[model samples]
Target: MAAHKIAHASYRGPSVVKEILYGISLGLLAGGLWKMHHWNNQRRTREFYDLLEKGEISVVVEEE
Candidate 1:
């Protein structure tokens, strides 16, 4: 059998600045989403407590 040679493919794409900027923007977007979710959770918890104070909802506990 004869030996065969394979060529390596080296493809270059976007610039470093563009890639860095894209990464930064994605990070900021994810952070903002996480913050929004956290704030919403806090607001919901506050509202639940307010409802509890007003006796709009009740929790039943069983003791043995």
Candidate 2:
């Protein structure tokens, strides 16, 4: 059997600043989305409760 020769792998990765920037960008994007979802949910919940309080809508139970 012949001996197999091994090859060296030389690859340059991204810089620290580039990695940090990417991390910050992804974090900001996620935070913004989360905040937006939370705000929309809160607003909807408040509106629902307000409508209920104002007698605009109500829960109904029927006897069966």
Candidate 3:
């Protein structure tokens, strides 16, 4: 008796439009995250400065 061989279909990679869309979406997500981080940092800095101005926070410096 002869052994039977199994054949499988090969997979085709993603199309150009799919790849382009993926790249665009990834770029947008990265930009959004960067913007969020920048906004948060600015907000925190502003609050810290406000606290300092209001005497709610103190800083000490010593001469060496």
Q: lDDT: which is higher, 1 or 2?
A: 2
lDDT of each: 0.93, 0.94, 0.94
- What digit string (tens of lDDT, one per residue) describes model 2 on residues 1-64? 9999999897888799999999999999999999999999999999999999998898776579
**Which has the higher lDDT value, candidate number 1 or candidate number 3?**
3
C-alpha TM-scores of all predictions? 0.68, 0.74, 0.72
In model 1, state the lDDT of residue 4. 89
Model 3 Cα lDDT, one tens digit per residue, 1-64: 9998889888898799999999999999999999999999999999999999998788876569
Task: Give one clash count per candidate, in the order shown.
Answer: 0, 0, 0
User: Per-residue CA lDDT of candidate 1, range 1-64, in tens?
Assistant: 9988889887888799999999999999999999999999999999999999998887766578
- Looking at model 2, how many pairs of residues clash? 0
Model 3's alpha-carbon lDDT is 0.94
Candidate 2 has what TM-score? 0.74
Worst 10 residues of 3 by lDDT: 54-63
- What TM-score does prediction 1 earn? 0.68
Model 1 stretches astray by more than 4 angstroms? 1-13, 61-64
Model 3 RMSD in Å is 3.6
